[model samples]
Target chain A: MMFYIHKAACISPQQTFGDIDIEQLHVAVDNKLYAIEPKYPHFNGNALRRMSKSTRMGAGAALPLLADNDKPNGIIIGTQVSGMEENGKFLNQIIEYNEDMLTPGSFVQGTPNTISSQIALINNNKNYNLTHVHRGLAFENAALDAAMLVNENPAHTYLLGGVDEISANNYTLDTLGGWFKKEPCPSDGLYNSTTAGSLSGEGATMFTVSGNQAGAIAKLSAITTIHSSDVAVVKERIKNFISKELPDGKKIDLLLTGENGDARVFPFYQACEEILDDQTAIARFKHMSGEYPTASSFALWLACNFVGGILNIPRHMIKRHGDLKSLKNILVYNTHKVGQHGCMLVNVA
Target chain B: MDRIVVTGIGVISAIGHSVNENHAALVMGKTGIIKGGGNFPSRYSGLLPFGEVLVSTDELKTKLNVTQPGVTRTTLLALHAFKEAIADAGLSPDELSAHDTALVGATTVGGMCLTDELYANTHGDTENVEYVRSFDYASVNLFIQNRYNITGVVNTMNTACSSSANAIMYGCRLIKNGLASRVIVGGADSLAKFTVNGFNALRILSDEACTPFDQNRKGLNLGEGAAFLVLEKESDATGKKNYACVSGYGNANDAYHPSSLSPEGDGPYLAMKSALESAGLNPADIDFINAHGTGTENNDEVESRAMLNLFGTLPNFASTKGFTGHTLGAASAIEAVYSVLNIDRQELYPNLNFSEPIADIRLQPVMDHRSAAITHVMSNSFGFGGNCTSLVFSKP
Candidate 1:
């Protein structure tokens, strides 16, 4: 069963949140890109004081999507890593103070579900809430859950999203673990790098999804993930998925590939490219959003608005061309370092 | 919709290391709470009681024949329970590696159980850098997936105490949606200084054994363990030993506070009502309820109020936290296994250390072990962040 995206919001490294304009893409000065945060005046001072960066970003992105006095029936969030900064602070205290005088603020705020729960608490929404924490399949899992929920209960709306944060400690750990590029590179030049790691980025994207399509920007047809390292297996799975999803011979107009600058997994993108139709426009988004687990969420937000004619596709990210007649179906494919691939199909509403 | 049934079960807690052992301990009304004694050293060693598994890390490694370096205690405990579940289901390694077999595991402290080592490594101590990559919540499931060659959809969930219940619910959804034919669902967590200290700071750690539903219940005793259940479609489990059928499940958030439930128990009421609706049954159809009674003053009273609001006369309900303490993420899955056991054995386990009921509700829990024909059992799990989940298990 398909679910519709009613409204979408994002707080990414680019100016993609309110009234997004692709012409004003924010460029990163260093290897890391930070989300452009927005002011939140609705939260009380004491409540705002206790929230971590991720919580604030998530709430900031989600609260605006809801109309006045709107309460969603559920809140589902997907986060690769949550509260890293708070966790780091707590761990530092444990080491510096010998675990005796440890404070509870950081420890309490460091849980991964705090983002989703905080959104629910702020909205006074007591509904079906859950958080998925898979490496790269996090957002896809959340979307899939939302789809199932709407399919089961057609009357209820849901707040579905993904959030991830990058702290100094997290960045250093990623660098040490070979997850970030050694030399600094411009954000727009991400796809041109001949390096092993991709630029690190963080963002939070939330959407109001339901069966109702009165104000929907896009229709989510399918969302799935396959776990395989072999390019041949992944290619076959994609072919099968396309065949199953597009049984009426409906061709895809655009394809969004999760091709970061990393050369290690470029072959997976190549496999996907080899199977796509020649007329399909192939585009990349990681260069602007940077590469992080759940970055596909930002890509989805961009696709929804781009199809809705509210945002334009940056010329540098596009590789192939499709005639702009009607601008219908778009597909997104993303993968993680450990061989988890996800695919999402969104169509113009 | 395809009917999902539990084909195999495995568990390892402070009370026992296997299903039969745990069931025996439950039938005998044996509590596992004790004054701390385990591999980890804590400042509250002599003062606080905890439900600690009685095995050392080295001993677990040796018994499991684990040769991989830097395997966290969380992974070891999960592997131990997963191996037993697969064996109980009579699934060969080849069957387990099938592309249609999905694995869904939950945990709050995956590799973070090695708190001191993680602290040292992240703080630039550099002595235990090998555990750097194993600190994420997915590390334990990834280790299991790679070790067992589970090629299908694998995911990790961390919803605090209600984690594994949600995992089980997700696995059932996968099967019903034809995403998988069989799924292994459960969770694992290990005792660590991080959790102990975190709970201590919240002032919810009871100094003595927890007494659920008691008038003077102080708080909860933190515990750690793992449990797994193999769920297969009814058509696929024709020849297998079916424990019970997963009839219904629901999840909701309180949206009240980060660590406390609302006095009205709105989330709990909605979750229970949704579960009953999904099961196509009324409140009168439920024979027993495995309450989410953490022995905390707020939880027991609020849960009682929710139950009273739903069923004017409560069922024969009790909290096994007195036996196993609060296992956090593992509590739901462990309670699920106990619920299945109650159906399979047609027995009711007693609620230990409950001498007096609360003053307001004045409701007494099941205090005597007895044999009865229980057709349906409902298990509840509520956690931090106001997440609440309920699952109904019916006799097959």
Candidate 2:
């Protein structure tokens, strides 16, 4: 049931695209992190003008991973709040102008699947297209969908991705909802904070996946999502997942935990750590990418880079750096406040 | 892959409230398109006809015994259908709360149906703060999952009009992949100012009742409702009363326009062809097609071309949108129930309000209700952003 990752591209707050060195990670300013903007001069001017930030980031991240000669068999995207800026504008116009003289541009671009459709139209890919918006489980669901596609139809390669954007109004709303910390903290300080909320961040990560293993960057082993708020139940589930994936009692090389510095949710990560072997090196990424619903996609991207030997582990993000001879297996665990727990396993290709 | 079968179905629309009622209305050629009522207040309220659910929010609350504040109409409609589906399937509370039972729901307008309330609340109007948590796209599904204590793989999809079709497809995949034994797949969407104004801006709302496949057809009338079907593996549904088997399904994007399909209907053609291939059946095996005919000029013409391209000679085809209007996310699920009904009852419901077919294609739909031995039925659902999905249901 393993699928190969042919290519991986990410447009995030870090220096992921056209990277020089992963060691020199980009830093956020004023407790906010935005994806590195992409420039697309070749796109049609009219279409480009109508594309929202989510669409731009999605298309930009996908352009590099897609081969010019081969069209994907399908395009699946996972997003938390797709086109929030456009949707907010649409709502604002309805309220401000009393629903009169409202434009359709924002409303048209505000759907969650607009990113996938835009990418399909740009690439002329008339394949299976879908979008999932299930909070933190969105990207994992997309990945699972890609895996299912590959399993069902092994002849075609698929494009899977996660895209989200941070807007001022959305940030203000999240602040009021106690989703963002009041004080500014450096990206490295996120894992250690005892704050009520974590810093807000957004990005888009795209991967080319298929059954073909030739020249794969990494291999996706397993993905599982559990909907539970009980810490004990989640802990047991994680234990069963690890044993099921590694039935031979093999040690996990590295673990990536989505500890976003929210004090209320950190215990779930701690419970995950309790099940890991003492030698399993634990790493954190929300410190670098900040906290978004699809932050796990960023973690997957980082794990692929690490397994591919393109990135080195940062000392500050590790809780208990385990000793391993080589990078063989990596596990990513993430949880959302809405009771979605997801675990993804990846290995060196 | 294991055979997937539908064990139960539930539906609530402008035309009817349950499967029996909707079937009766369909057989009688009843139309639910009427002048606007309910809480939807718009500038074009009286001028434009909409397929509004006859029940008011208060009435729905009283009927369902809903006591929770800030519950949107979208969730209420979903709960109504979901409860019916589960009950019809004879699922107990313990079985529903099992870890192997999954729930996949879809909705374009979740809590956003309360457009004014959300807009006011987001603007520092703290009086309706309770509504803030209900604004997410997963609110309806979450509410249903929590109510039924569904602990399995719960996911929400939002792919515009094709949302529920994709949900059903996803549920099938989960069972085929051995991830779950049973999955409830459906979608719900209530009428909202957000959608009304959005469609108005697109100029697709019809002032009169829609006339699908007719030469002088006006645009579509927006509708609201919810529908769901309980899906389980054939082995697990041994003793259950199976409505129909979900033999095959396919999804594709048009890659053409955001709001309109290509004149050639490439996406629709490929989706239908793929579904046939997945079902291991030729085009001739299909007894009927439930077209995604939104009663719009662009959709009808393009879909007709697509059907012509695939079947060469079209089969018995009709668009139920003429009866219930376009229910957006809920359209495909509702149509899926209709497809099952067609199979189980061996019936063909007429395409209401159709005088003549499109001049170019010149293919006329069934003009009257009739009984026929049907083997397989194909249901098509196309959405904004060119998302097209086709599902095949076979007699069980």
Candidate 3:
């Protein structure tokens, strides 16, 4: 196996294992959904006091939840807005200081890779580390890299993850760009909604992926990202890939969709719905994650949990078909309204 | 094991645009470091010299032959260097796409130069909403992918100064593992007040010319540039021109400081050791070393000590920071290009302005440029967040 996710942690708009269970997640009618306020001091207190909002929460998720003896292979983080919150603060200081002087702390932490680096600092991990940023495919690209690392060198137990937060200023910019939906999907049924924008959610999810299969959560089967002008081509590619990989139509057991109540990008999700029959139970995660470039990471985390039989589909998600049996194969498809698409496959033990 | 070889190299740094220009300047001990040109308030900047590019944006655009790139100066530099590298490899557009080619780019500034300018102009005016779209690091790589029509494993790695080294290392792995037949790997960075002020706030800017491994070394001088290399698998490289063969590489985090390196140089020490081990060679096999040697008070001394510990006696080693200054994200890739040049020309560039030694062990670098029968060169690039990467290239 190239990659095996041993443990996964996430902090999103939903209750992501810190404050409460999945049933207690917040319900929002507006497309904007913020992560439940994370308790940073629970992981690293001093860092909690020093770090900015995104950095603290991002670093917190990378901390191991299960294993305490085994050191992680390394840390890899994916982010679209690295330290934009701190960057905005630094810019504000520059303006307030009249170009005379400003605190370098915010500027130092403002880099896109600062979160990953800070995680390394906290964990004291000197192993192979990387930070990848590609708008919609940021986490997929990062996940793919982590998988390759485990494949190339089995000595590594990688932490592959992604984090994205909505800054006040940048969120407004997204609002102007039509990325954030005006109204959020109801908590009772997220997938049934007909809305213009996605629930704006922010989250950070990390998994300990290793090549060793002993006590592994799930095995990464394959991953492919395409930037195409036509959705039909994407469907064709997916069909062709599945045909070549599976001869007897082994069939995916679960299909994870990144439908965030946005009607425009639902066609890709519909394509997934059309390709697979009732054997594959369809699920949507954008209701919990909201919509971010790397929000597919959240879907991937949920997929792995579902495959491991550790998580049951939340009532808010769209469940098109099939009862949760021995979950085996999961295929996730995510696309932004502006045409960034990602597809990934996860296989359970 | 399949070997990965550098078949072509291109760079646009402070010294020159093309490989030949930079090589000539290095041999002649020329410094690209110059005083600021009133781009900002000079008083606040301490009159520190920087390695600003000589070519204009329009000139670079014309050279790259891009009509509507919709990118900033950083992407233009990357495109120019990438085209030269591809052409130098003698690969046509059809060959590039036919072969499994991956594009790995690194940049710290991204499109901040243009975005900053636009943001400065549009302080509060929401009329120009286009600038907001430019606030991303993926745009540069996406543009390159589109321009070259490369369709495999296109990604970007940003690890501060060691960004491109990370990119190059990833490309090397791609070829070694039979993932890609060929890979274009390197880094790009452009001048921007955002990065400059960021570094300045850390108080690491040097007023005088940077002096690597010197007792009185001050700090690094910021620069802007880009460089790239076409790496092909050994099996696929038959009958094809080879710039230099990649022998080995290693990446280690200091786990010491977020910005500063470990006082003991543990990261560099492990990185160099791992690289040598990966190459299946000893430190004695290295003919020359391109030290990270950023000339900062902390870096130069620590790197020198790391050298002394690794080789016992330093070989022909020098810091090209004097010629190109420190190009941040582009430093490692630019130095990779320099390594290929060294192996091909059998030359060792001088470490300009290195009059005195810093470390008590007193490792002396090749103070003046010299030409020899170069066989292998080891290059080091360490960056913020304790990222340390080392690359070893050999004559093809």
Top-DockQ structure, candidate number: 2
Please, what are the lDDT tens digits per residue for candidate 3 over residues A64-160? 5424745576778888757767776666555556444756887777777777777777777777778887778788778878877888778678788
Query: Candidate 2 clashing pairs?
Result: none
- lDDT winner, 1 or 2: 2
* Reference-based lDDT, residue B291, model 1: 96
The alpha-carbon root-mean-square deviation between model 1 and the true structure, to one decimal in Å, is 1.8
lDDT of 2 by residue, A106-213 (tens): 899988899999999888989999999877788988888898888887778999999989976567666666778989888877777898888889999999999988
RMSD for all candidates, in order, please. Answer: 1.8, 1.6, 2.6
TM accuracy, model 2: 0.97
For model 2, state the Cα shift of residue A91 in Å. Answer: 1.4
**Candidate 2 Cα outliers beyond 4 Å, as residue runs:** none
TM-score of chain B of 2: 0.98
Candidate 3 TM-score versus the reference: 0.94
Docking class of 2: medium
Question: Which ranges of candidate 3 are over 4 A from the true structure?
Answer: A28-30, A42-46, A95-98, A182-197, A247-249, A322-326, A336-339, B37-46, B62-70, B115-124
| TM-score list, all predictions | 0.96, 0.97, 0.94
Candidate 1: give the clashing pairs: none
Deviation in angstroms for A130 in model 3? 1.4
lDDT of 1 at B379: 97
The numbered model that scores best in TM-score is: 2
